[model samples]
Target: MNGIEAPNRLAELRQAAALTQQEVAERVGVPVSAGQVSRWERGEQAPSLRYRHRLAAVFGVGVADLGIPSAPLPRQRSSAEDWFVSDEQDPRVTKSQDEWRRTRALLNQNRHSLSQVAADLYPEHRLAGTGLIAGGGWIPEQPVDLARIELSEVPDAPEPVLSGGEREAARMLPDQTLTRSYDRYTRAVRDLAPPRLFEDRVSWRLLDVDWSAGAGRMSFGDTTYFNAVDVFEPCAHELAYVALDADGGLAAHPHMRDLPYRKLIGSPFDFARRPVMPAISTLTIRRGAGDDVSFLLHRRDPRAVAAAGGMLQVIPSGIFQPSSLMPAGRAADFDLWRNIQREFSEELLGMPECDGHGRPVDYTSGPFAVLDQARADGRLTVHCLGVALDALTLVGEILTVLVVDAPVFDSLAADFVERNDEGTVVAERFPFTEGGVRGLLDSGSVAPAGAGCLELAWRWRDVLL
Candidate 1:
C-alpha cells in the first residue's frame, strides 16, 4: 500500500480543529486554500507528517490522532473490489494495524530526516500531524536517529473503487441499508473536539446577464394559496453541495465546517469567469435499486468504511429528483445551456432542471443553467449557490429568473401562458388524470422568502395540489 487515502480521518481532523483553509495554512505557516483542504478530504492529495504535525499543533491535538491506520502495504494491495464489510465477520483491517506499527517505528527513528525531506518538499512548511516546527514528535527538537531509523514512504492501498466488486457484492449486499451502522460513527463525529483557533471568510459575486427573446415563464396556480416567493437571488455563480445518507437525512459531514464560512455549508459564491466541467466521465457503476447499495463497495475490502469517513458515495437513490417527467431533448437542452453559458454568459440555466446526481441522460456537459437572453421584465430573478454530486465543487451559484408569465408568451398563445397578467396561470387541464401538473391557478404574485425555498416547494407541490 503506497497511498491509501484517509478522507474520513482527515475530515475528522478538520472538523475537530474547526479550522478554515486560511486558518490551517496560517497556523502551519503555509499558504493554502479551501480547495486544498477539499483535496485532502477527497483523497486527491496528502500532506507529509511534518505538515501533519503542524496541523496537529494548530488543532491542539496529538499527531497520532491524525493517523487512522487502515490501509494495505507494499506486500499487499486491495482494489475497490477486494474489500467488503460483512455482518458475518469483522473486516480484516489487520493490514492497517501492521502499517501503523511500521510507521510509528520509522517516525521515532528518522523524525529529523523525514522532517528535512518534508521541509525540502515544502519550504517554510511545518509539520501537519504534530503541528510543530521542532519538539516532542517534532523533527529538530527530537530528531529520529537516522542511524537506527529505517525510513521509507508510508505504504498505502490503491484508492478503493466499486471496481468489479460491485457485481459480486451485489450477491451478498442488502437491498436497504440500515442507518444503525452509521450511528456510532455519527456519534464519533459529534464528539470531535473543536479547533482552538480559526480565521474564516465568505466571498460572493454577481453573474450579470442579458435578457433575450423566445424566453417564457413558468408559474404554479397553487403558488398563490401557498405563498410562493422568490426565495433565492440569481446574482451568485456559486452553488452549495449537500450529501444525503441512506436514511434520507442530509449528509452533514463534520469536516465541511472547515470551509470558509461563506462556503461553509456549500452555501454559494459568486464568480466572474465561467466554470468548466469535465468533458466526459464514464460511470463505473450505474443506478441501483433500494437497499441494493449493499454491493456498492470499492474492492470488497471493507476499507470503504474508512473512505466513507469524510466522503459520501452520492448513491443514485439519494439524489433529489425535482421533476419526474422525462423529456427527450433534456440532454440536448442542457448542452445548449452549457454552450451558451461558455460562449456567451457564464449563467448555467436556460434548460430543464436537474437532479443533483447523475443526469437522466448520459453526460453531455453539466448541471449548469443560465439567466441570459432567456429572461423578460416580469421574470423574477433568483440567485442560487449549489453543488453537484458527480461533478463535485460548489457553484458559488447562478442566477435564474422565473418569469411568472411572459407577456410575449401570452400574446403569442394565451393558452400556453400558465401565469398571465391576471396573476392567474391557466392550467393545461388533464381532464382525464386526477392529479397531474397541467396548469397554475393564480401564481403570479410573489410571496416572502421563507426559511426554505417556497419557490422550489411550489414547483414540486404544484403537481399534487
Candidate 2:
C-alpha cells in the first residue's frame, strides 16, 4: 500500500481491535498523545520507522500487514536513525511530557475551585461548611446501623447507555486518560503496582438509601471496581480537562454540559444510568479525657492513588467492599464496622491491602480481634455520620467517625506506621478542636467527605463525648 492508504488502514486496525486512540498511544511503547495517533490515522502526519514498528506490535500484526514498508522512507531520514532514538530523544515525547507536567500543575492548583463549583451546581445535596452533599436526610451527627445496609445480588446489571452526544464524544476523545494517569502514578511510586487484581474485584453499588426510620436504610447491588474506573473516574478527568479553560476559568465541555447529579436527583435510587459506589471515610478520634481529643489525617500520595490524591483525608478511608470474592465472605463483610476494621489495618497499620483474592478475613484474630475486643469493651465507638456524593465525580461516601478511648488508641498508635500503601500520616495528629477543624477546612486541601465528617463530629462532640 502507498503512504496515504497505509495510514488509513491503521485506523481500521485500531477499530478492529476495539481500542481507543489513547489506548493505542499508550501501548505503542512510547509517550505519545492521542492527538498524535489521530494525526497518524487521518494521514495528517506520518509515523517514523520506530513508531510504525511499535504500532505493528501493538496491533499484533506484521509491518506488511499494517501496509508499511519494512525499509525507512527517504524523507524520514534524520541525523540519527529512528530505531536508535530513545523516548527522551524524541521531541514529540518531550513535548507530550511537558504538557502533562503543566496539566498536573493546573489540576493541583484548581482542584478546590472545581469542587466548589460542583457543590454549587448541586445545591440540594450540598451540606453546609463542607464540600459534600448528604441525601436521604442523612446528615452529619446522625448515626446509621451497619446491619440495616442491605445487599441485593445483581449478577447481570446492564451497562449504562450513553447519550448520542456522549457516545460520539467517547468515540472521538481519548478514553484512557485515567488509566494513563494511573500508569504515570505507578511508575513514579516504585512500590505501587497497577491494581490489576483490585480492578476486577467485586464491589457494592449504592442503589438506594432511606433514613425516615431514624437510621440509614441502604440498598446495594453487586458491581465491580472496573465499572467505576471505566465510567465515573474518566468522567471526572474529562470534566477537569474540558471545563478548565486556558486561563483556568470554568466552562462545561460541550458533550458533558448537563450535570450528572442533576440527571439522577429525580430518581437517585435508579442504577440504570449511574452506578454510585460509596467509599467509607472515618474520622478516627483519640479521646483521652473531657476535652482532650485528637484526630488523625492522611495526605494521600498523588503518585500512589487514583482518587483524592494530594488531599488531606480522614485516616482509614476506603471503598466499601468485601475482603474476598467468595459468597460467604461477601455476606460476612457487608457490615460497616468490618469494612472499617480492614481500612484501619491497611491504611493505619501498613498491612497489605485486602485485594479480594485472599481467604475470608478472620475477625477473631490479629488486629481485627484487637479492634473487635475494644468495641465490645466499650473502649471504641464507631458511628456512621451520614452519606454524601462527591459533586464532581458523582461518587458516594459513607461518612463516619470512630472514637477510641485513650488506652485503646495508645495501643493502636504504638503500631501505626508513618506511611502506608496509599499515603503518609500527617506528621502529628491534629487536635479535634474547632480551631483545628476550621484550619483544615480553610486550607482547602481536605477531601469533601473528610471535611463533612470533621464538621459533623465537632458539631456533635457533646453527644459523642
Candidate 3:
C-alpha cells in the first residue's frame, strides 16, 4: 500500500471502542499525545510505521483496517511533501519542481497583465470591453436563444491528433510535473484538505462547436478529469510564463521552445490538437421591475481550490458533468440548465456534491422540479450568452445568465449560504448598474470568463430584465 484512503473513520472506531484520544494514546504504549491522535483522525497527518502498528494493535485491528499501509512509510522530501507519496528520486523530479516554482512566481507577479496577451493572441474572439474570447459566434452582441442551444454526447468521438512537434514536446515533459504541481497546491493551502485526483472521473470533452445555421450546436465526448489536469493545466501554466516573460518571451523560455503546441494558444476553436473541457459559468441575477436588479459573485478561496484561487467569478460555476455514472444519468444531465442547477445547489445552497458515482438524479421532483416549474411559468429565465476560453488557462467556459423574479429569489435566499466547498459568496448583492459592472470588470481580480459573462449580461439588459 502507498497513500492511505482519505478521511479514515478513526473517530468512529475510537467511539465504538469507548475510548478517548488520551486513552487511545496511552494504549499505544508510546509517547503519543492526544493532539497527535486527533491529527491522525482528521487526516492532517500520518503516523510513522511504529505508531501505525501500535495504534492498530491498540484498536484491536490490522494496519490496513485502520487505513494505514502495512508497508514501511517512504522517506519524504521536504520540498515535495504531500499526502500522495512518491518514491522516485530522479533528477527529472527536481527539474519539474523548479519549473513549477518559476511558473507559479511568474503568474503571481503578472496576473493582471494576462488579459492583454489573450486579446493579442485571439483578437477575433475578444469581447469589446472585457478580455475574454467567445468562440462559435456566441458573443454578447448575439445572444444564443436557450431553445436553440443543442448538446449531443458522442461516446466514440475521435481522439485529437497531435503534430510531430506536439508529440515530441509531450515526450519531453517530466513525468513528475503533475504530482509536484499538486504537492505545491497542498503546501500552499495547508488548512484545507487536498483534493483527490480522481483520474477515472468522467468529464464532458468538447469535441466541436458549430453555429452555421443561426443555431448553437456543441458535440461532446467523455474524457477523464486527469487527462485535462495532465495535458491542459500545465500547458496553460507554461504558456503563461513564456508569454509574459519580459526578457525574451516565447523565443527565450527554455520550456516554451520545446512545446510547439504553445502556438495553439491563439487558436481557440481548434479542438483537434487538444481536449477542451468547459465549465458552465452562470451569472445569476435577482430582478423585479425598475431598479431592482442585483447579481451575485463568488470570491474563490485560495486555500481551497487549485485553479482561479483568490479570484472573483460568477456565481454557481462548475464543470459540465453528470451527477451519476449511470448512462441514464448522463443522458438526463446533458442539458445546460441541469448542470447550472447542480452548481446552484452545491455552490449556493451548500448542498453535498454530486460526484458522479451515486444513483441518477431524478429531475422531476425536489428543488430541480421547483426550478423547472419557475422556468415554465416565466418566473425564471436562463440564457446562454456565449462560450469563452480563459485568457490564462485556455480552459473553456459556457457563459450563461439566470434571472429570477424578486419574489422567487427572496424565497430561495432563505436557504442561501455564506460559504460553500469552493469559497465565500459576497453576502451583499451588487446593483446591476453600468458603473458597478464596469468597476468589477476593471477590478483586475475578476476571472476572464466571469468578466465576459457580466459584460454580455449587461449588454442584453433590455431583453433579460
Q: Which candidate ranks first by lDDT, i.e. highest?
A: 3
- Which 10 residues in a row give candidate 2 its minimum summed lDDT? 188-197
> Against the true structure, what is each candidate's TM-score?
0.18, 0.70, 0.73
- Candidate 1 residue-wise lDDT, 86-201, digit = tens: 21212232222223223322222232232223223222433222111211211121111112222121123222121112232122111122321212211111112112221111
- CA lDDT for candidate 3: 0.68
In order, how many clashes per candidate? 83, 0, 0
Model 1 C-alpha RMSD to native: 26.3
Per-residue error at 175 for model 2, in Å?
A: 8.0
Give me the runs in candidate 3 sitting further than 4 Å from their true place. Answer: 1-99, 105-112, 162-200, 212-214, 243-259, 264-266
lDDT-best of 1 and 2: 2
**Model 2 ranges off by over 4 Å:** 1-105, 145-172, 175-198, 247-270
* Model 2 pairs in collision: none
lDDT of 3 by residue, 405-426 (tens): 9998888888999988778999
Prediction 1 global C-alpha lDDT: 0.25
Measured by TM-score, how close is model 2 to the native structure? 0.70
Q: Which TM-score value belongs to model 3?
A: 0.73
Candidate RMSDs in Å, in order, are 26.3, 11.5, 10.0
Using TM-score, give the best candidate's number: 3
- The local lDDT score (0 to 100) that residue 164 gets in candidate 3 is 23
Please, what are the lDDT tens digits per residue for candidate 2 over residues 375-398?
888898888777787766667888
Top-down TM-score ranking: 3, 2, 1
